[model samples]
Target chain A: MNQRNESVEMDNQLAEFSDRILNDEETARAEGLTGELADLEKTVLRLNAAASQEALNEAQSKRMLLRLKERMRREQEEKAPFWKRFFNPQFGFLVVAAALTLFLVVNAPAVVNPDLSGTATSKSGVYVAAGVLTLFMAAYWLMRKK
Target chain B: MQNNSPHQQEISDEVLIRRYLNGEVEVFDLLYYRHLPKVHKRVRYVIPPNDVEDVTQEVFIAAVKALPSFRGDAKFSTWLRTLTNHKVAEYYRKRSRKQEPQIAALTETLAHPDNLSFHSVEERIYLQRALMSLPENYREILLLRFAEGLQFNEIAEAGNRNLEATKSLFRRAVTALRHCLEE
Candidate 1:
């Protein structure tokens, strides 16, 4: 047989041998098996050990469950309508900041025009504070998206 | 239902899933705890140790989202195992996008002080190192068969291969792992 066919037959034999050994089925001695099959059995034992390692303790499991609960809550909120979503305080803050920006822009001329002096500086200061707050909120939203 | 209660312990996963779908959300906690160790072990085989918990959590979250579509043709544990595998694969895809190091480097960082008791810490580390040297497909097949306790036919179905091909693949995978361990 060609090398490819030979190798496949060998693999088939090895697989059967390993299965019999693993299942503790009575079989003739494995005298004709290649050394690779013996080494493979040893490796399988070690791999099984490595794979079955216990990493989660009760406390860690509880902590993971808690996080999953929080995630489920967040996902549920995300699935809500826009109006429902805005009910969240974080979204409410964004909406309030957006409204303040619109109000300040519309009222800007009255507060800081050259036609109106004296109080223009203080009124402009108010606009500037509002502008800074709007900018901060916008930046926060952008950063969160990033 | 409270997980520790004797009543809850007697309920099967399918029954719990049905209850959860019927709006008894507390039943999900029982499912979560029931399958946590299985999911955790499965994820750890393919993912970096530090990321295993997060990936495991993501798996259940995915399961919760996908639960509505489940038709109960297979056991819930089988469905969850498939989901866990998908999440682990997704994690590797994301890591590759960010140009992270290879699996060997990730496995090297898996040596937490707490995991030393499974064997001599050295032997565990050696086995992990050997596993990291293997191709991803080989490692996955070995894990599904041995660690996940999948029969050869189940593995064939999962991988879309014929039973003989799957057995041949398993034998080759074991041989490759043996060579790596020897090295």
Candidate 2:
């Protein structure tokens, strides 16, 4: 046989041996197997037995699925739109507190000095907005660390 | 909890994937259970026992994340197997960075008599180490055949290679593994 034909023949033999071992172990062992094919068969049988012993049972699988679900949930939360995540209950309280503080800071200046408020309030508004954004970001970072 | 409805079991993976893409989020449970045993088995075959569950979870998580882009050009199982391969590779890459001795750890675990039930633990350790030493293509073919339980023709299809070439590759791979084990 040509090399190609010989290789094909070898592949066929290996496959047959494997199938026998996998589907009918008793009969496969009964065969007077030898050489590389026999070695391969023995390896396959051992691996199969080891794999079965190591299998994750239904309860373990279910527990894994639950863990996966929790992971997927957290992933979805992280991937949610920024504003949506910002409003999540964990951050909601902080967001409400920040918004209330921002409202007071922006309006307190105007109430304090209505005449000078235009330029003064606008200037303070920039500072207050920056400060609130920084505070919000710091809070977010802290929450993530937790 | 998995919904064990009889009709749910009847839906094909492709159909379930489509349903999942179309807002049927719960359909993923069917996909998960349908393929978990084989995926888990394949992971357990190659991964260290302590790390197998984590790697299996990584595979499904990746599949779930990548589902939207799944073009259905290949079977779902094949796609998942490819994904599993990537996760296993990633596990090794991360381990290489940590510089932990994988074989030593495996051997240590095997040393415990209660943990092993199949043939000699030394034989299994050698087989696993030899498997790890194989070239990627050879190792992949072996895993595809014995680990994932793909038929020879199916392996050819998954790899997009001609049957003759795949068969030849399989023969070569088995030879290499046998030689590795012998040494």
Candidate 3:
């Protein structure tokens, strides 16, 4: 807080400004600037080359994109399951179509070669599946109507 | 792309926004890099310095989310500047609701505690309270100027007000701040 220290601080500020002025003059001279304007021209390239700024460079951008994708995926996951895409009666015929696909998938050849004795006495697997599907369809229709 | 072309000399913010929406993400980066410094600076005025960077990030996040809905009734820069203002306002609202009571308690303790001596703490509290109590527009515009370095024209554009009105608003804000700070 003494006069000496105050003057030192002022000197530092002036030096910084003069350094800026000299750089500007050099640039102007290179560009063929003439007259007093050239002399006055001070190009200070305060271009910071040290400690590179954390710009949203490609890597950082990709990271951000990944984060966004992850957040969107999580939100979708928190929503209804994929099957609801079919069961969501708001989908109406689309739901019906998905249901039919699921039905086919569940009943399609499992190659289990059903136990021949278990098959006849227990009733045909296709018949059993048809019966179950009928019940599901009826219940789904009723639920949807409500 | 010509450096000397008159049409290309000034790329309207609207065009940049449209390019961004059309999948030119680099345009978004350009827009972000262009405005982030001012946004971060504004954030510091309302929030503490420590949280300003976080607020800056939040502003950009909000901008990206809201970009799809921007039909561009106004300039894109204006829209972003508004978003920054809104985010800053929301920061204050959220902090006051979540931490004001804790801060008040802390202040009382620090002021009255027997063993610990805290100097200049009361001034800090006074500054915070004075800022928070200002009408939202006044507090916001003043901060946007001093802290954000936005020109008066830009402030008017962002606030969606006329230049004269913006100036009057700033005048009113300074008057209120002076009164509050003095008290």
Q: Candidate 1 overall Cα lDDT vs. reference?
A: 0.73
Candidate 2 lDDT by residue in tens digits, A34-141: 776677666666655555565566788789999999999999998899889766765774775578577766666565676656676566775676677677776767
Q: Is candidate 1 or candidate 2 better by lDDT?
A: 2
Candidate 1 on B1-183: residue-level lDDT in tens? 124788888988888888999999988888988888878877766565557788898999999999999999988888998898788779777877775534443344555545444234446556655665789778778777655667778889988999888878888888888888778
Worst 10 residues of 3 chain B by lDDT: B115-124
Error of 1 at B73 (Å): 2.1
- Candidates arranged by DockQ, highest first: 1, 2, 3
For candidate 2, the TM-score of chain A alone versus the native chain A is 0.45
* Candidate 3: CAPRI quality band: incorrect
Overall local distance difference test of candidate 2:
0.76
Please report the candidate that would top DockQ against the real structure: 1
Q: What is the TM-score of chain B in candidate 2?
A: 0.82
Question: DockQ of every model listed?
Answer: 0.33, 0.28, 0.02
Residue ranges of candidate 1 with Cα displaced over 4 Å: A1-34, A52-54, A86-146, B1-6, B101-141, B150-169, B179-183
DockQ of 3: 0.02
Give me the displacement of residue A34 in model 1, in angstroms: 9.4
lDDT of candidate 1 over A1-146, digit per residue (tens): 69878777767766665566445473344455557556666666566556455557888899889999988998898899988866766666676777777767776776757565456666766668687776769765775633
